[model samples]
Target: MPLPRTAGSALLALALASVAVPASASSTAAAAADVRYVALGDSYASGTGAGSYSDIACTRSRNAYPALWADANDPAAFSFAACGGAKIPDVLADQVDELDEDTTLVSLSIGGNDSGFASTMLSCQYSTQSACERALRTAGEYVVNELPGELDSLYATVRARAPHAEVVIVGYPHLYKEGGLCLGGLSSAKRTAVNQGSDLLNETIAGRAAAAGFAFADGRPAFAGHEICTSDAWISGSNVHPTAEGHESAYLPAFSAAVSGN
Candidate 1:
């Protein structure tokens, strides 16, 4: 049975706290000799807010974390398959093919779009708190009720396609500090909700990754003190996508560590 939306947040928190999977650094690093890399996900993965776009349609950026990670590591083969507006279904249909038997590494930051996080943020930013609450509630329902099965199926597909690949599932960063003073215009209540929602999203991703035996990279700590609400914010204006620096400093390192197993 699908979990109630109201219980989703609590369940997600428990799941995140219980994660025991280590970072994929060493496992992926060892495979660097013949690595066939593929990067996948949504706007965050494509580097939407970071600018210096490589593809206008996908908003892929040369400075995006995936690009930077690839440059630093020098993988034998790399394909950036993530798109700005992708959901889990899009990945199953379009991006999964990028992973084949020879694929040595696959990293992705997904599930945010499946949860309608962008729309929830927009509703919160531009509309009433009640509207924001409603949007988030709906998103939470999707996270608990639908996202898990979708991720499980996707992971299975990837495993079937690339049995030898080391898969790293990256989670989103927290947009705001919980109850901290902030420069961003969002109200404290809104910020709290967003942070909580981000947690739920990350936990959902992490739990699924753990269950699938894929490494889960928690990006929250990487983004600590560099949230959209901070003076030296690494997240952009809407508190969603990362800035180039955020990708380089936070995401790049996190991904590198995950893949290199360092």
Candidate 2:
């Protein structure tokens, strides 16, 4: 796998220094390369509420994992087929021409929805209570049971669509950390439980991806300490999207790792 870019520590500096050179110079950096990249997932992959995309029509945006990977790699070489709030079936649904025969890389961050993670979180209302913790735990189990079949379908779909592509499935970032609750009076132990639940889903992602002949980027560790409720917030608005900086700091690592071919 390509490992996350340590060079990102220096990317902002390069972009800022290059800004004075004019549009043409920036255009050179933005130009597409000859690699095919495909992205499929929910809001984290959607770039929703991040205010970046080709346009509003697709509801898909530019800061999602695929676009971030593209910016790091050759732009022309990549394509973003990910849609916001997408489920495993949704990925199966989108007709990704870009994901077809020529794709060089593919990454997906999904399964949280199947776990009813969003619904659970919403019910907790960001509280810290016993009820909330149990909900998260239940949601996790749901995801564990559901993801394999869903992921198997996804893998088959990719194989049918992008036969030669190196498909990479990106796992979930930790959603809760340090006992911050979905509501009032929740235990920190539940925080650990919810995170563990999310981890279970990740393991499922890894297993299924492996079975289907695809690689999975290790995002949980990379995204550690940067959960949706993290002090620094790596996950974007709620349970869906990732912030622009969040993608840079969190999701981008997985993509970079895959591209590294390490």
Best by TM-score: 1
Put down candidate 1 lDDT per residue, 1-262, tens digits, no spaces. 9899879989988777666333355566665668789998888899998989989999999989888888877888999999999988898889888989999899888888888877888998889888888888999989989989999998899899889999999889988766666664678888888888888889988999999999988999999998877878898876468899999999988887886556
TM-score per candidate, chains pooled: 0.85, 0.75
Give the clashing residue pairs of candidate 1, or none.
25-260, 25-261, 26-261
RMSD of each: 17.0, 11.2
**Across residues 1-262, which tens digit of lDDT does each residue of candidate 2 receive?**
7535877757766887677677766665554444567777776677776676775655677766677667666645655666666777777766455577777667777776767767776656565667777787687666667668877887898788888877787877776666656433235675566667677878888899889877788877877777655567666534345677767777787667765444
Specify the poorest-scoring 10-residue window by lDDT in model 2. Answer: 178-187
Best by lDDT: 1
Whole-structure CA lDDT of model 1: 0.86
User: What's the residue-level lDDT of 25 in candidate 1?
Assistant: 59
* Candidate models: Cα lDDT each: 0.86, 0.69
Off by over 4 Å in 1: 1-31, 180-184
